[model samples]
Target: MRRLAILMLLPLAACSSSAGEGTASTPAPPPTSPQAPAQPRDLTTNLAVPWAVAFLPSGDALVTERDSARVLRVTPQGQATPIGKVPGVAAAGEGGLMGIAVSPTFAQDRFIYLHFTASDDNRVVRFRYDNGIGPLQPIVTGIPKGDNHNGGRIAFGPDKYLYIATGETYKTHLAQDKKSLGGKILRVTPTGEPAPGNPFGSRVWTYGHRNVQGLAWDDQGRMYATEFGQNTYDEINRIEKGKNYGWPEVEGVGGKPEYTDPLLTWSTDEASPSGLAYAKGSLWAAALRGERLWQIPLTADGEAARPVPHFQDRYGRLRAAVQAPDGTLWITTSNKDGRGDPAQGDDRILTLPLP
Candidate 1:
């Protein structure tokens, strides 16, 4: 969900326990030094309030803009054209054109997956784009939605399954309620049915999340997610099957011993993390409230390094980030979507040099 406008106004909550424990807890480990960029480069500019971006086989970027509900085909040369429009989007507080993913087998299927909040419920749809025909078909439906805490991030995992992040929809306790779809990571087939052997035997992979917005996988095939916190800190967690990360019951780590703990936590003031991508032995998160790009170096052990902010405040609020086939980072802007001071060109897709 978008946090740029509402962030500064929300009353701050006291710092909670880091990861599941409260006070006087043992420090996990000293974070390593921040990794330096190989050589930073300013890629391109001029776009709408883009919320998400994905790369095509040809190296072109497919970007989604929130308020406008438009998708664009972006070239390395900075050229952009409207690809098509998604249907049934409800643009409000945090709802709009949210996430886009190219089919894992795009070379053959030419399918594209989208996550958006509809007038009723938030839904996932897989569609085809065959040139003349516009927005194709809806493959998944019936996800619960709320004005706040609408977790709307989707991606294809290394296992060739579609994964979805859900929020508790302002109903905090729903996070722990296994019967409901909110506040859980859902793993499903390309056709949107629960995949075989899911932890809950339902669609849920893991439960007890407040509002998860970022999903990525490391080289070792471990899944990681970024979640929005109410007041104190935002979290980065290693997602495991059947393990519950304390939500309404716990904020960061240090709530109850039974629940899984977060791998890393950052001041919400410093990070309203959204899209997450792992590449080159590191993880990158787009910071909406922090107005920066964060690069975290992961140990071979798969734990998080201290977050290092890049282009701090230079490019407005960043919403979604992804690594392209060419090894460059693709990032989108969120300024034009009723948040922050919109740059003359508040929304645009950018390419960053990765080490």
Candidate 2:
């Protein structure tokens, strides 16, 4: 068994104990840090390569299955029900139904957005969920798609504008191309129009990203994103409007004046980070290749402090990390995603208490 180590530079709070896997608490070594909470409990299991998770106003979560193109409603108590399969999803290598976001005004508009791969390209669509998914309304389209690097993650920023993250689709030059939607973070209105005050007249908010898969906002509404590097590094960037994050030109950090450097970087083996959520004064990131959950503490100035790893290799291929309405963190495993080894209840959602 791999030995677990607890290291702390700041005093972190603890969550109420709960029944779950690895429930036997590992005693802390010294008087420096508090004991880590019990291992996360399985919320739901047997999912087919679950990709993204979004919470409805009712507190139930809607989860997406990448290859199956199905949407499932998971109750707070861990019951999952397949609402419907998304139409027009072309599941291929690393591309399929990926990101889901509930409208900020979901209670009134009943709108939900999805980012998925189509037969020709990757796109974002809007649907009304009355009881089932409504007709497909394509809002954003023409994102480049390839066997890998189909950047797929979407969320509504505190500004109420929809933010879309896209990859270069392995076409390196596209990362610097302003006209192309691929390899960029786009800011658009709920109706799919270019958001007012966008640096570029088009939907492009920022450019020069390799593959961005995670987006989150801190308490002060500062934006952050996670990007995958070619082979050397993975990055957590403090997002700013119109800033260029050097991609092919600079893999990790280039002191070049024209491009913005990442706030923090990790070796690719340590963090191929995916879904990200902000809670309890920290950013929680889910790692795919590293198979861990990273909690990065933030300073008062919105800078990253130190990142602490949890559940390293405990769950296989952690994909999505989302904070539920009740403050608990919900994470999904991706063991059934073809690249991972599936366990008995492969592709499961697990819940942990936030510190």
Candidate 3:
């Protein structure tokens, strides 16, 4: 151990709880400061349209291959093994196998939930994971699907209910229709039933969303979602149950009576927001057209500050940004998703320390 030679005098510290009389002990030398920004590293390469990643309790990641409709169990050593195929996935433009969520009680139930585009609609299903993944059961279905704007991100909230983000599929009226699952945030149980405390007594938690692709929660258990604007504004919203988010009526902020304004908004060119993750007291939003990660520092109550962009244009078309169980930020490139130019190993999972 190195010797500590301090010039300033200090008061005597209390002895350890187990110490005898007059036996003094140095207090845990003031807890050290936190550290970050340890250079990004590619965990796995040669992925095809990787959309979202969810970690198993064992720390192996369950990654969704959007176009192929397959799930790969990616190990920490950059090795991937095909766990199994999510059945009935029909791939189309921006619609296919999209988001994944491992059960909060996965150690016992071993249930994995998946969001995918079917032949007619986008849907959610739960499947058991034994040695292989199989025996799919419908969780929620009949979300209107189209070539684009099929929002598919699922996450289990701190309340232990699954939250699903759905796009309007370019249908203008569906956003305002509470009866339709399209363009709405749906909350349900693991078995596909409406969560008990849902605002409308149905799976539709909040209506009037154009395209919501990202869902995250802060330390205070408040929810936040990233939404795609029509042609002008991209937005980050503080989601509350049963509250209306102005979509077809208002793009960004109208401050209307029936609608909740977004917490933060950006130009469409700057942030075509997709996957979002809350880590290190900030919301990290991924962009597709912007091809960058927006790090927006958030207050305890989930207020947003000026966002700082990192890894802009260096990596082409980021689609998914998530924080792994071990506190690492994992991002996926969307260059191969028929939108941007594909580089060598075009799509991949890049892991970095949360800054």
Leading candidate by TM-score: 2
lDDT by residue (tens digit), candidate 3, 1-355: 1111112134323211111000011223322333335667889999899999999988899999999988999987779898877888999888899999999999888999999999989999988888577888888989999887889999999999999999888897999998999989999999989999899888999989988999999989989999887655678888998999988998777768888888877766667889999989888898887788888777555666556678889888888888888899999988888778899987989998875
Model 1 spans with C-alpha error above 4 angstroms: 1-35, 38-44, 132-135
Ranking by lDDT: 2, 3, 1
Q: What lDDT score goes with residue 127 in model 3? A: 88
All-Cα superposition RMSD per candidate: 5.5, 8.2, 14.8
Q: What is the lDDT of residue 8 in candidate 2?
A: 24
- Model 3's C-alpha root-mean-square deviation from the true structure amounts to 14.8
TM-score of 3: 0.89
lDDT of 2 at 305: 58
CA lDDT of 232 in candidate 3? 56
Put down candidate 1 lDDT per residue, 275-345, tens digits, no spaces: 89998888898887778888877888787654567888888777888988888888877776565677765
Pitting candidate 1 against candidate 2, the one with the higher TM-score is 2
Native-to-model Cα distance after best TM-score fit, residue 6 in candidate 1, in Å: 23
Looking at candidate 3, the ten consecutive residues that score lowest on lDDT are 15-24
TM-score for candidate 1: 0.89
Candidate 2 lands at a TM-score of 0.90
